[model samples]
Target chain A: MTNETGAPLLDVSGVTLRYKTPGALITATERVSFAVNRSDRFVLLGPSGCGKSTLLKAVGGYLKPSEGSITILGRKVMEPGPDRMMVFQEFDQLLPWKTVLENVMFPLLDARNLSRKEAEEKARHYIDKVSLTRALHSYPHTLSGGMKQRVAIARGMAMEPDILLMDEPFAALDALTRRTCQDELLQLWEETRFTVMFVTHSINEAIKIGNRILLLSPHPGRVKAEVVDVDTASPTDGSAGQLEKEIHDMLFSQEEAH
Target chain B: MSSKARIVMRPLEDAGSGEVERELSFLEKAWDNSGVRKVAIILALALIWELYGRWTDNALLFPPLSDTFAALIDNIRSGVLPARAWTSLKILLMGYAAGIVMAGILTIAAINTRLGSDFLETMTAMLSPLPAIALLPLALLWFGLGNGSLVFILIHSVLWPVALNTHSGFRAVSTTLRMVGRNYGLKGFAFIRKILIPAAFPSILAGLKIGWAFAWRTLVAAELVFGVSSGQGGLGWFIFENRNLLEIPSVFAGLLTVILIGLIVENLIFRTIERRTVLRWGLQS
Candidate 1:
């Protein structure tokens, strides 16, 4: 699926997003652009105030860019569709009334128009992948935070979307749980090599998960730099630490300059 | 030189290592059982009522609890009380069902569109505060001494609170759940059935309960008015007739029957529903 000449799977060209509150029109991102190729672990990295999440939402078709365009496989993104599944950060993202199996099968039944048996089969398969097969009948509130995220991921993965858009999915988890969840996500990716566009503020996470990273500036986010060839750099070695430090310095230097 | 005087302070051994479990005493266990406690309270109240009624020596106003019980048993054995209760319950069910249906429609509309929500708010605001019994005269004039008048007032009593509570519940459904529904391409009725209903079920259950209570009370009140001239009447009519005939014990029996029915429906019917739904879903304790 690696292509140097063909059009990227997801194309975000000069997109800007703005939202309105009761009084102010807040510009979340401005002229942010990136392309995600098939099977790419593309990460959007930025500081707290930056609009990486907003950008991801725009790509997910939940938010429309105030200016510019986002296209998925040459089709203009207009609204939230099953083709762009999202795994949110909140533990409450899973439907509390739905058992883990039902939560995973919901999108399959709704979007894929699968029969009940087929949906159940597909849902169970994904649940097994996330090691949540034992919790198939358990409700969301009964599950731990990590387990809920797994269910959410299984739900997203079960749909077999063109690209999964994850917005800081492990950010709310404890450190040990977060690490385990990150590892599980990578293992799932290794098995399926599914394309994912992940948004996070953690540099370590970006270095570990993303093959290609897009760094954005602070509030009213704009593209600052793109770090490529991340997969070739060994994560446990001195080079990974060197790269982390260098990116940290670049990000901070930009803030210092302002 | 003072090495012997130097003492070491060490942490307590096996601190927080395990939990202790103990068997409860008979009294403690009985106290823990809500059903047993409730029955105890009821028995105590009945004893107090019997004592007070005997001391006052006023059979016309406050009959002894024992007398009321005997009257209740006599009415039950004659099947008159059961027939009247069935009549009231039948009418209550009809009005309640209709009210619930109307509430469902109004709530669906209220959540879906701006104009629909405005309409619901306006109607509830206008009608909710106006007591259902207050409409009894108009209902009597329009429907004319029948179940129609009773049902009209009963529906009036049931509709507003159900609609208001359902709307509020629907509004309280989280935005993330709505987004999840939209993300799956669910819209219209599917959206409501899949996402909104379950998410807002606790509130909806509360609405149903409030509506049931309102409908029950309204049916009895309306029946009281209708029973005066009608050949056949419900429990309310029975109570009114007993009052007129100076059968105070029978009147107390009629009131006891009403209370019993209320308790049954609230505990058995509504509590069972709560146990199966909101409690099971962990939406409510």
Candidate 2:
């Protein structure tokens, strides 16, 4: 069964992702490598043209790697499964027809084989964790962008997946709301300690959210370096600002070299 | 103008608690009612019809509104109109249901495969614009002189619009939503039923409406033609008979019946569905 107790929860080794355009085939990621241990807050930090999101999608099993492999719990990723739940950046990720409660319960019922009552109870718990119990019945369209993201988070988290893939989830929010969401996410992480692979371009966000960060260079993304122990950075200690500056320089120097 | 201007700062005046609500005037209230407005418009049209018919003074050509109403009541009393209406409705439903099922199958196939999509697109382009009645002669020759012929034409009328709208609706579903569905391990028919159907419902409903309208008109026209060679038929046949017997008011009554049925289906059935699904879902205002 190749069951290794010490195997990383997610092991993405030299993975390459190629996608088709109208007239061309483009490599989105080239030999990008990273490993996420159990309960690791892994962040993929890069510029807009970088394939961080694409890499995350590959790990989510939405996109198959053209080269190398992504193994989760010693099993190769073949396709999207409940084990790797993804929360997309777009607010439209939440089903417009389903209320917040139903959105959270959908996967619980579909993949987890939960009864309706069980699903509802689990959904409510997650909704409460996201502080959205009052908005349980609200449709996605009626909610603010921040609220929609929370519902999406609740939906993803409720699945109790092995890993959660977040593709710049709070990127579209206003700065203030983005900060609040980031804080809420960290608080939620503190409670559940679930592993998450967050992809974002914001250096500050990467520093704030990631305990382990993998920096990728843009235009067919390639891994530049890995920053470990980001959790040591705190606002009071000024390490957060130092780490933010370090990330900025890393990206800037890589861009200059390119 | 001076480079530096003097600035004045003052405390803001206290605005009254707030203007929370206002009572609408009678005219505004009445005008705000969609049903009232539609009824008024219908009454106005009836008034115009009566005035025009009376001025023409040619009952054989154009019956007045009151005479048409009387004919409608008389036909109902005799049970002929209801019987004819039922016959037409029953046939229409049979064709409509068949068309919906076919459209659903085709659209689902199209979503699942590239070749199926091309097939749907090509078939819709070729057949959708070709008037369904234009195929009635061919339908008649193939199916013989009966409900079969009418049903074939009705199917042709209903199938294309439903397929086109539903296919396009399925296509228009957002990539993010599709990913979310798949992220939950939803695939095949489960993916379609859970994600695609609801996401594309507004477009699907629109297609249904267009198909119904086309089917209804085609049914009436096909019936009128059928009366030329066949025995008994629906409202169209009633109108044809009334015209042959020089009962002009009864013809008007038959025409009125068709319009009323269309209105009822559109307003009651479709509107109710729209309110319950898409409107409540905030897909449409």
**Pairs in clash, predicted candidate 1:** none
Off by over 4 Å in 2: A1-5, B1-20, B228-231
Tens digits of lDDT, candidate 1, B1-285: 565767678787758765588789999999999999999999999999999999999999999999999999999999999999988888888888888888899989889899999999999999999989889999989998888888888888888999999899889988778888888988899889988888989988898999888888887777777684356689999999899999999999999999999999999999999988888778998
Report residue B241 deviation for candidate 2 (angstroms). 0.6
Error in Å for residue A206 of model 2 = 0.5
- lDDT (CA) for every model shown? 0.90, 0.92
Runs with alpha carbons beyond 4 Å of true place in candidate 1: A1-5, B1-19, B228-230
Shift of residue A194 alpha carbon in model 1, Å = 0.8
| Highest lDDT against the true fold, candidate | 2
Count of steric clashes across candidates, in order: 0, 0
DockQ of each: 0.74, 0.88
lDDT of 2 by residue, A57-156 (tens): 8888888998999999888999999999899899888898889999899899989999999999999999999999999998888999999999999988
Worst 10 residues of 2 chain A by lDDT: A1-10
Lowest lDDT block of 10, candidate 1 chain A: A1-10
